[model samples]
Each structure stands twice: as C-alpha cells, then as structure tokens.
Target: MKLKSGCFLQHLHLLLKYTACMSVRNAAALMEHFQLLDVHRKNYLNDLQFYCFLCYVTDLNKDKIMLLFDLLDRNVRGRICFNEFYTVVYTLLSHENDLEKQFIPRHAGRAFQLLDVDRDNMIDFNEFEAKRFLFNIQKEVKKIFKDIGISGDEQLNYREFKIFAVFCIDKQQKEEGDHE
Candidate 1:
C-alpha cells in the first residue's frame, strides 16, 4: 500500500507524540495486559487487529497499520516482545524532525551507528534482528524507520538513502490516497 506525503507526515507526527509519552517496557506490558494476544489467537497475529493495536499505541493512522506490522515482523513472527517493539519505535523517532515533515540523514546515520554496535561499519542480520535495545520511545522510533524501509545495507550511499526516503514518503502518500 502507498500513502501520501502529507498523510505520512501526519502519521509520523502522531507516532512521535505517542512515543514521547510511552516507554518500551510500558508499551509491551500494555499489550499483554490488554490481552491483545488472545484477541489475535485465531489469526495468530496474521490479521489486521494486531496492526491496529500497534497503530493504536503509536497514534498512527488506522490505514498505515499494516505497514507497521510488516516492519515489525518481516518474517511474520506471531508476536513481538518489548525489545523488538522498542527497536522499531526508536528507529522511527530518531529519523523524524521537529515538524515531522522531513527525514534527517544525520538522524538516520546516528540510528545506523547505534544499530551497528560492533563499530565494524556493517550491520549483520543478527544485528538487524536483535531486540536488546528495546525502550518505549525507541520502539516507536524504530517502527517509524521500519515503515520508511531502512534496511541494514552498506550499499545505501547518501544519494541512495535520500532516494529511499523519498520513496517511502511517496509510498505512504499513495497508501493514504487509496484509503481516501
């Protein structure tokens, strides 16, 4: 699905605000406390409700819920723990600006640096999948970044990163359009 730049910006802003008030551990506990897992037991999280929960927590538009799910579990894992949740949220917030209208390369760079814990200038699959850094704000931030599609590929130069950012923004806009 695709979304409009304006809608994407709006959703991004909402997500940032949501993250500001929530911690990763708190968010995780909330999910458990709400019995969201039982709600999804039939589909085992292969349904839209799971995404809706994420959108509900992150304050994202309902339309972008699926995108969040895709980012959170690319491998279609049935569940996401606090660590994984934090990683997703942190990645997103780190890339957004005050206005939430632009994607800062510097922020992305910083996020990449953090993700590359070994300082080897490369993020292995394990690093990409690691949920050890889960924090509430961090989880929402990472989710935002995942929605923007920031894979751990060294081949993404500055130019490529810019293109990817644009692509993501455009995709979000298109998705919003479809919903409208």
Candidate 2:
C-alpha cells in the first residue's frame, strides 16, 4: 500500500484528471451519495458501506471490494473519510481505464517523462530501476535491460521504454489473471 514518489504523483495526476472532468452537479450528486452511504451520520463509511458502494460502482467481487476497503482505510479505524473514498475510487477508475487502453505509446511517453528526472530524453538503469515499481516489474533490472534494450546501448530511449512498459503491464495482467 506504500507508493513510491513517482507512483504517488501518477495517482495524484489521475485524481486531478478525474476532478477536472467532474461537473459541479456531478460533484454534488457524489457528495449526496456519500452522505447517503454514511448511514451512521459520522461523515465516513465503514467497511459494509464501502463494500456496498464498491459493488455498485465496480465489477469487483465481495472479497476484492473488502480488500480494497481495507487498503483505503488507512487509519484502521474501521472507517474511511470522504476524501479517502474519492481518491481511491478515482484512482481505481483511472487504473481500469488505463488497462482498457492497453497502456499505449502516449501513456508510455508520460511514464517515461516522469521517470526521466533530468529531462535527458533517455532513461538510464538507475532511473528505470527507481520507477520500476510503477510498472509492477519485480524482475532484475539488468535482465530487463537485456530483454528490451534492443539497441544494447545500456539506456532506454522512448521506443525501448515503451516496449519495456508494455512488457511489464502484460506480465502484470497475466499474473492478475492467474490470481483470478
């Protein structure tokens, strides 16, 4: 549940995008929905309410929803505030959307931009290894470099990085499918 700096920024970017797309009326409606879900009038949702809300909004099963709820409930207080609810829901929605698009080149470009901290237009092993968690890649960095760096220059330009990103996402999705 602990996100690295780059992953945190990505989630923040997603939340900002979600907020940008939300109309005032839609925001109000969401607030009202949150209020309704706060049956105890505590201005927060317990596990049951969160589970129901996730079930209504997403296709995830009971167990997964509960697990998501647990993750979102950062304080272990058995409740999640409206901000936590909003952030986590939008982040989940954004991730699902990204998956649907199969993480295209544009997405890879943005990811590369984030990882290339020096604006060098290339990613060295350190940069790639630092941000590897964002792509859910647990493989050894050197092995991945050998596999995807077709140019064998020991650095990844956008094209090579795109291939690496796609490879990681494909592997992550396959692993998720296996769990399912």
Candidate 3:
C-alpha cells in the first residue's frame, strides 16, 4: 500500500501511544500489549497468534479472520509485524456505525487511497485487480460491474468505489453466512 508521506504511520503511532493515556511514558505500552503475544520474542506474530488477537477485537468468523491474516501477510512470510497488525485492526474496527455497510467515507477513502497507487483518484480494473485479494475478485470481474449496474466507463471514482466496496463486503458476508 502506498502510505504517501508516512502521515498514516505518524497518526497510528500517536493513536496507539495515547489510547492508554495522554502521557508519553505510556508510549511503549500499546506495543507491549502486542508483544505479550510474541511468546517466542521473534518480533512478529505467527498466523495462530494473529488469529488469537483478531478473536478479541472482531466479531468476524474464523474464515474471515484467516482471510484477513492472509491479506495482511502480503509477503506470504507467515508472519506479520506490529504495523501490519495495526493497519488491519484499525481498518476493521475504526468506522462509524451509521455507515457500517458502506464503511463510511473515511474508511473507504483510506482504502481507496491505498488501492489508488498511482494517485489518479480513480480505480481502473488494473488497480482493482492489484488489490483483488481484498475484494475477493478472483473471477467474474466484469460481472461485478454488471451486478452493480455500472455501465459505460469501467473505472470507478470515489463514489463508485464506495459502492464497489459495499458490494464486495455484502457479497462476502452473504457467502459466509450461506456456508454457515
């Protein structure tokens, strides 16, 4: 993901540091909580350890949790750093309840920014394909636009991207529910 000027990292650092208290002395405390799960002290969490953390923070099922782990472990290294974990957790947990289905503008904007690697403010099929894992767009790529009735130009602006994100989330949730 293109984090641009590292602003996200700075904000995340402050977020983790201050969630406990306003004091800088508690800066290391949030990271320490994540480290507690690093029983081997490898400075990273394995899939099992990652899943354990997800279980506490999200109501998502085991399948969804594993899918997220795989996404976060983009390098397929079988391990994830604190930053990766924080990114996934923040995306999953930080959003307004009123826009839960659509993920709210701020959440969708963050995601759009990540996917819009070229900073075009638009998501073409290639950009969409690059993050296919997030949307689970393994096949029927064209069908997605068809289902959403987005004709003419295939590229998605922020508004259309929000619709696409909601479409994918709803479809995945429904599919998961069916499996249950």
Best by TM-score: 3
Q: List ranges where model 1 is wrong by over 4 Å.
A: 1-31, 34-44, 77-82, 88-180
lDDT of 2 at 18: 27
lDDT per residue as tens, model 2, 1-180: 222333322333232432333445545666787898898999999998887766655556776566556555645799988877765544444464454124334356556665676678888888777555344466645777777877777788889988877676677667778999
Steric collisions counted per model: 33, 0, 0
**What tens digits encode model 1's per-residue C-alpha lDDT throughout 54-152?**
554455555445544454554557555444444444444433433122433434564455445555665443554453232112222334344444554
Residue 10 displacement (Å), model 1: 17
lDDT of 3 by residue, 44-163 (tens): 999999887766654556786776676567677999888776556444333311123533344577577667766777778777775654433344465685455365577788888788
For lDDT, candidate 1 versus 3, the one ahead is 3
Give lDDT: candidate 2, residue 77: 94
lDDT of 1 at 12: 37
Choose 1 or 3, whichever is better by TM-score.
3
Per-model TM-score on C-alpha atoms: 0.32, 0.46, 0.48
lDDT of each: 0.44, 0.62, 0.59
**What lDDT does candidate 2 reach at residue 50?**
88
